[model samples]
Target: MKRFSALGAMLALAGAAPLAGAAPQPPSCARPEWPQEARRYELEGVTTLNFRMGPDGRAIEPTVARSSRWAMLDQAAIASLSTCVFPAETVQRVQGKLLPLQFVWKLQGPDRVPPALVEGSCAASERFDRYVPFDKGVSGDDGVLVRLLVRGDGTPYGVKAEAGGADPALAQAAVEYVQSCRFAYPKAGASPGSPVSGRVLLKQ
Candidate 1:
C-alpha cells in the first residue's frame, strides 16, 4: 500500500488556517445534524474536509484541510457532506456570506469488502478485445481492480488503480489501453458530461 503519512501531516498543518486568498471568515456554528444512516460508514484514515456554502446552499468549493491516506475515506466524507441540507434560515441570514462547514470522517468500524464489479453502460467490446489483456505481472496472483471514469463518448476521462497488488506497469498499460478504446454513445436520452464509473479486474 502507498504510504500517505507525509500528506496527512501536511493537510493537518494547512487545516489550521484558511487559504491565503479565501474570502473573509464567517460566523462560527456547529455542524448540522447528519442522518443516522450516514453514520454506518467506516471512514478511518479519512480526511476532514471544509466546504464553503454558496448563497444557493450548495457547496461552492471543497478543500481538503485534513486528509487520511485513504481516498475512499476522503470521497465518503465529501459524499456525505454533499447531501447535507444547510439551514435555510441561516442561509438567508448570510445571503452574501460564505459559511464554513467542517466534516470529520470518523470510521465506524472495519472496512467492508468492496463489490466485485461496479459496471457502467460501457464495456470492452470485441473490436477492443486486445486492449483488455491480462496483467502479466499477476500471472499467478489473485488479481487487481482498476476503476475508471469513462466519458459519454466512450473516452476515458480518469483512471485509478483501485487495488494495487498488480504491477504498476500493468496498471498503466490498462489505463492507456482503455483510454484508446471507444464506445457507442447512448442512444436514448442526452449524453451526460459527467463521467460514468466502471471497474476492470485483472486476474491470473
Candidate 2:
C-alpha cells in the first residue's frame, strides 16, 4: 500500500512536466515568473509538487508534482505551474539539466490538518518497540506524537516530538529509537517530500 501510494504520487508529478518539443532556444537567459493566478492560489493543504527546471531558468516542464489525493488542488497546481517561471541563472544552468524542484501548496488561513495527517501505530514487533516506556512513570500511555522526516529508504532524516505531554525522557527515547532505525527507499515513483506519520503507544 505504501509503495503504491508513493508510486502514484510520482506518476502525478511526472505527468505535470512538459513533453520534449522543438522550439528555438532563447538568445539569453530570462527569469521565468510564476503565473500570478497560480501564485495567488492557496496551497494551504498537504500537497507536494515536483518539477524540472531547464538551464534557462524557466520551468520547461511542469507537472502535478505531488498531491494528497485532492483532485481540485492538484489540478490547480498543474495550472499554476503552467505560468510558473524560474530565475534566469537557473534556466541557463539547468537548461539541459533535469533537476527536481518541489512546491508545497499552503492555504491562506490558519493551518488546517488534512485527513491524511492522522497517526498510526508502530507495531509491537518493530525494533523501536524496545524503546517504549515500560515503567509506570515512564510510559507514553497517552501516546507520543513524533514528526519524523525519513529518507525514501525509511532512514530517519529528522525527528521531532510534536505533542502528547512534556515527558523529556519519553521524547528522547523516541527520538533515539527513530534515529537508529532505517527504512527501505520508497518505490521509484514516490514523491521526494512524501510525509509519513509515526505513533508510539505504550502498553501497560
Candidate 3:
C-alpha cells in the first residue's frame, strides 16, 4: 500500500504570496514522504518546527519546536520544510518570529495491522537511538538499501547493498552499517537457521 498521499509532484513548490490579515498556516510546498522505517514500524505522530528565513528566502537553522515523540518523523519534517522558499519581502515582514511549520503523519485507512516482530529478522534490531546528522544541503532521498544474511546467533553473516543507482561509497557505508548491527535471534529453544533479509534507510 502507498502510505504517503502526495498533494503534487514530490519536489514541486507552490509559491503563493503571504496575504495580510490571513490565518497562519504552513506554506504550500513539497510534502515530506514518511520515513520508510517509521512506516514499516507503524510509527505516527505530529512534528512541529520553526525556522528563520535566510537572506535567499530559504530556511535557516530549522529547529523542532514540538517533537512528534519520534526522532525520524521530526527529522523528516525538518528536511522537507527546509526546501521551502519565501519572498524576500514576506520574510522581512516576519523577521521577528520564526516561520511555523507542522507535519501530521497518519496511516491511511481503517483496520490497520500492528507491526509484528519476526524471529531472526534483522529488521527487529533496527534502532533509532543513533542519530543521523541532518545536512540541510543534502537531499532527503539520499540513502542505500541493504540486504542481509543472518546467522542463528543473531549476527549477520552476509551483508551487501542491492545493485542500483545509489552511490558506491554510500552503498559501502550501508553494508558496513548493517554488518555492525547485531540482529534479533530466535528464542533459545527455537530453531534458527534461515536466510533473512533486511534494509536500512540512510537519510542524511
**Top model number, lDDT:** 3
lDDT of 3 by residue, 1-204 (tens): 225444311332112233232224434455677787666444556777767667776778889877765567788888887767666566666655555666777766443222222423333223221212121112124555454545666566556554355566765766776665665543443324333333455533
C-alpha TM-score for every candidate: 0.32, 0.32, 0.45
- Judged by whole-model lDDT over C-alpha atoms, candidate 1 comes out at 0.42
Winner by TM-score: 3
The local distance difference test score of each candidate is 0.42, 0.42, 0.53
Alpha carbon lDDT of residue 40, candidate 2?
29
**Residue 85 displacement (Å), model 2:** 36
Q: How does candidate 1 fare on TM-score?
A: 0.32
* lDDT of candidate 1 over 90-195, digit per residue (tens): 4555445433434443433333222222234335543223332223222213333344444555555555543445566765655664565554444554343322
Q: What are the per-model C-alpha RMSD values against the true structure?
A: 15.3, 16.3, 11.4
Model 1 residue pairs with clashes: 43-107
Q: Which residues of candidate 2, in runs, are more than 4 Å off?
A: 1-140
The sequence of per-residue lDDT tens digits that candidate 2 reaches over residues 48-77 is: 555566554455555644443334546655
Q: Which model, 1 or 3, shows the larger TM-score? A: 3
